[model samples]
Target chain A: MSSHADVERRLGELLRTHEEQVISRWTQSADAPRDELTELYRAILRAIEEGGRDLADLRGLLAELSRSRARAGYSPAETSKAVFGLKGALYEIVVAHADDEVLRGFIRFARLIDDLGLFTFEAYAEAREKIIMDQAEQLLELSTPVVKLWEGIVAVPLIGTLDSARTQVVMEKLLETLVETGAEHAVIDITGVPAVDTQVAQHLLKTVFAARLMGAECVISGIRPQIAHTIVTLGIEFGDIVTKSSLADALAHAFRRSGVQVSGGPATRVTVRAEQA
Target chain B: MERVPILKLGDLLIVSIQVDLDDQTVLALKEDLAEVVVARGARGVIIDISAVEIVDSFTGRMLATIAEMCRMLDAHAVVVGMRPAVAITLVELGLSLGGVRTALNLEKGVALLDHVRGAVP
Candidate 1:
C-alpha cells in the first residue's frame, strides 16, 4: 500500500504531467474562462500537496469562484462541472497507471473533492439570495411612479401588491409630487393591484386622508368589479373619498372641480350630471 | 423666540411654516392664528407646512387646535403644502388632524379658499 507521502508525490507528478489535460477538460466542460480554469487547477494541486489537510483554502477558492459565476449569471450545473472536471482529469491519470495502492489513493482524493463541490453550491445559493433582494428593492421603486398629468393634477399609478412598505413609498412620492407640481388634484390608480384586503383599504384611506390634510383632494380610480366586490364583502367604507371606475372618469371629475370646461370631446354631456360630494 | 410669519391676503390668512416648529412656537402660532381670524374677520386660513421636515404628534395637535379655533371664528382652515415626509410621519403618529382641510400647495390652497368662500356664502 502506498503511504500518504507516496500519494502526495504522485498527485504532484500527476499535475506536472497532466496539467494541460486537466485545465482543457475543465474548460471544455464548464465553458469557463481559461484564466479561471488555470487558477482552479492550481488550487486543487495545492490542496493535494498539503496532503488534503485544511480544506479551508480550497473552500475559499471555490467559494470565490462560485460567487463570481453566480453574479455573471452562470448556471449551478456549469460551476459543478468546472470543479468536477478536475476530479475527472485526476481519475483518468490515476487509472492510466492503475495499481492497487494508487487507485485506492484516488478514492480518498475523490471523497475530498466531493466536499469542495458542496462549498461551490453554498456560494451559488448566497449569490442568488443577494440577486433576489436587489430585484425586490428595484421593483418597489418602479411599481410606484408619481407623474404630473395636468397643470394642477398629479397621478400616482400603482401596479402591485399593496403592502405597508409600498404604501409608504406611494404616499411619500405622491405627496412630494403634489408639492413639486403644485397640484390640487391627485389621481391614485390601483388597477394593477392583484387583490384588495382590509389592510390595503386602510392604507388607501390613510393616503387619501394624508393628502386631504395637505389640502390636496384625492380621487381613487381603477375600482374593478372584483375589487368592488371585495371592498363590500370586507365592509370597508371609503367615507367621503371619491371613487371612480376608471382614470378617465376621475380626470373628468377633477376638471369639473377646477372649472376647466371640457367640450368637443367626451365629458361634455356627462359634465351636467351631479357629482357625489 | 422665532415665530412663523402669518401673512394676510385679502380676507384669507396664509401661514407658511418655513421652519421646524417647536412646542413653544406651535402654541404661539395656535394663539396667533386664532387672533388673526378673529381680529381680521378672515374668511379663510391656509397653513402651509411645505418646508417643515418632521411633524410629531405634538405639532399635529397644534394644527388641529388652530383649525378648531378658525372654525369658531367662522373661517375655513386649510393646511397646505405639507411635505411628504411630514405627512407620512403625521399619519404614522396616528394624528390625522381630523377637522383640518389640506391642499397640495399655495396656489391650490388659494384656489380652494376661493371655492370655499364662494360656496359658504
Candidate 2:
C-alpha cells in the first residue's frame, strides 16, 4: 500500500511513463478520432499540470473542444464521454502507483475532472442552441420572400407565427422590397399563418399602414375562413384594407386597380382607367 | 412666430411643412391651423410632413392632436408623405396615429379626401 506522499511524488513520472497506456485505456470505444484524441489528451494534461489546484486553466481548451465536437455533429453522450474518458485515463495512473492513498487521490481527481466534463456538456449545449437559433432566423428570412408578381404588384407570403421580432423583419423587408421593385400594389398573403389573434392582426395592420405610407396600396390575401372568423370574433377591424380569399383574388384586385382585368378563359381584357365612376 | 403655412385651396386646406419644427412652432401651427380651418370653412386638410425627417413621440402626438382637432371641426385630415424611416420609427415607438388617415404623397391624399367627400354625401 503506497502512502499519499508516495502517490504525489510518483505523479509526474507516472503520467510521463504511462501516458500512451492511459490514453489507450480511455480511447477504447470513444468515437473521437485518433488525431483529435491525441491533441485533446495533450491539452488535458497541460491543463491539469498548469492548474494544479483548480481546472480554471482548462476552461478555454474545454470550451473549444466541446463547441467543436458539437459543431462536428457529435451526440451529447459522445461529447460527454470525450471528457469523461480522460477521467478514466487519470484513474489508471492512480491505480498503478498508490495503494490505500489511491482511493483518496482518485476521489479528488474524479471531482475535478467530472466538473470539467460538466463544463464540456454545458458548452456543447450552448453551441448547439446558438446553431439552432441562427438556423431558425435564416429560415424565417427565407420563408418571408417578397415576390414581384407583376410590374406594379409585389406579394409577401407570410408563414409561421408573427412574433414581434418576425413582424419587424417582415415590415422592413416588405417596405424595402416595395421601394426596390417600384410596385404600387402589395399583396400580403397569410395562407401559411396558422392562426390570427389581436396581436397578429396588429402586426398586419402595422405592416399595411407602413406600406400605405410608402405610396403603395396594400391588399391582404389568403384570409382563410378560420382567420376571418377569428378576426370578426375578436372585433379586430381590418378597416379599409382590402381583404381577399386567396392570392389570386388579391392579384385580381391589384390588376383591377392598375386598370387591367383577369378572366378565367384565355381571352383577357384591359379596362381603361376612365371607367372609374 | 415660425408657423407651418396653411394654404386654403377652395374648401381644402393644404399644409406643406417645409421646415424643421420645434415644439413651439408645432404648437403655434396647431392653433393657427384650427383658426384657419374654422375661418375658411375647410372641409379637408392635407398635411405634407415629407420634409420632417424624424417624428419622435412628441411630434407623433402633435400629428394625432391635429387630426383629432380636424375631426372635431367636421374637417377630414390626411397625413401624407411620411418617410419610410419615420413610419418605422413611429411604429417602433408604438404610437399609432389611429385617427389620422395616411397617403403616400400629397396628390394621393387629396384624391383620397375627394373620394371620402364624394362617398360621405
Candidate 3:
C-alpha cells in the first residue's frame, strides 16, 4: 500500500518529468521533427485513466507537465488553443463521472486549468490582466445567450458590466439570437450594472448600433442615478439608443413604437427628440 | 453624440439609460437625478434600458438599491428594456430587482408608472 505522502511525491515527480518532456519536445531541433509531443498528451491521459489515482499526485504531475509545455516555446495563440483542448478533455472526464466524489478532484482541476494555461503564457501581461479584470470577458463560463418571449414580446435583460470582450460576445450572440428568433424589438434592462467607465460605455453604444444594423430596435431600461450622472460628465451620447426606466416602461414604449395598444388602459406617450451630436 | 437626457412627464421622470450606464457620466447623473427627484417631489420614475448589453450583479444590486432610495424620496421606480439573454443570466445568478417596477420601453413604462402612481392613491 503506497502511503499518501509517497503518492504525492511520486505525482510531483511525474509532473516534473512531464514538464521536462514538454520543454524538450519544443526546444528540440526542428530538423528532427518530434511528433511525440502529441502522443505524450495521450499517454498522460491514459495514465490518469488506469487505476485508482490519487488526486494530489495527479495534480502535481500535471502541474509540472504544464510548466514544461510553457518552457518549450509555446506561443500565446497556441497556448489558448491548448487550453481549449485541455478543457474539452477535462469536461469529458468530469461529465463521465459526474456524481463520484473522487472525480470531484478532477472538477476542481478543470477550474484551475485556465489559470495554468492562460496566466502562464509569457505574453502580454497587460492583456492577460485586462481579460481577467471583468468576469464577463472570462470565456471559461459556459453560457449561450437565448431569447425568451413574454406576452408576445422579446426581452433581453443584461446582468453585467459591458467590457469590450463581453460586448463583442453579446453583440454576436444577440444578433444571432435576434435573427434566429425573428424578434422585432429587443428590451435590454440594465438596472444591475454598478459603474460605467468611458470604454465600457462606448462598448454599449457599439452594441446598440449593432442591434440597429440587424434591423431590430433596442430598448434600454434601468437607469440608476449614478449611471445617469456619469453619462452627463463623460459627455457620452446615446442619441440613437432608446432608453426607459423599467422593463414595463420599455414594453409600453415598444407597443407604441409598433402601434400596438393594450385595451382598457389610460394611453400615455412621450415624444423623444434626440439631441444632435 | 450628446448623452441621453432624463425626460420628465407629469410627476414621473423618464430616464433613457444607454448600455454604458457603468461609466463616469452615468455615475455623475445618479446623484443629480437623486437630488432632482427629492427636490422636485417626483412621484414616479421610469428608466429605459434598451441600449445595454451587460448588467452584472453588482450593477443589478445597485439598481435595486436605487429603487429603494427612490421610494424613500417619494418616487416609485420602474426598469424597462431588458434583453432576453441578460435576463436569463441575471436569473441564473439569482439576482432580484427588490420590487422595482419593470417595463419593455419608455412608452409602456411611462404608462405603467402613471398607472402605478394613480393606483397608489
lDDT to native, each model: 0.83, 0.80, 0.61
1 versus 3: better DockQ goes to: 1
Measured with C-alpha atoms, the lDDT of residue A25 in candidate 2 is 74
Q: What is the per-residue lDDT of model 3 for residues A1-277, given as tens digits with 9 covering 90 to 100? A: 5444444344334434455454343434221124444444444444444433534544444444445554676555564455445445444434544544424444444555554455435443444455576554354133335456443357766676666656666666776676556565777777766777888776666666555533457788887788889988999888867888777788878888666866656464655699999
List the DockQ of the predictions in order: 0.59, 0.39, 0.02
- The lowest-lDDT stretch of 10 consecutive residues in candidate 3 chain A is A25-34
Candidate 1 residue lDDT tens string, A73-190:
8887778767777677677778788877667667777787777777788888887898899999999999888987787888888897899999988988888777677787999998
Q: What share of the true interface contacts does each candidate keep?
A: 0.81, 0.40, 0.00
Residues A1-277, candidate 2: write the lDDT tens digits.
Answer: 7755554445545566777887787777566767767766766556545545555547777788787777788877778777788777677677667766556656655776788788888887888789899999888778778889998789999988888788888888888876566677999999999998899899899988778766678999999898889899999988888999999889888998977766555355655677657
Of 1 and 2, which scores higher on lDDT?
A: 1
Candidate 3 at residue A109, lDDT?
Answer: 44
TM-score of chain B of each: 0.95, 0.97, 0.85
Against the true structure, whose TM-score is highest? 1
Query: Predictions ranked by DockQ, top down?
Result: 1, 2, 3
Interface RMSD (Å) of model 1?
A: 1.4
TM-score of each: 0.75, 0.72, 0.35
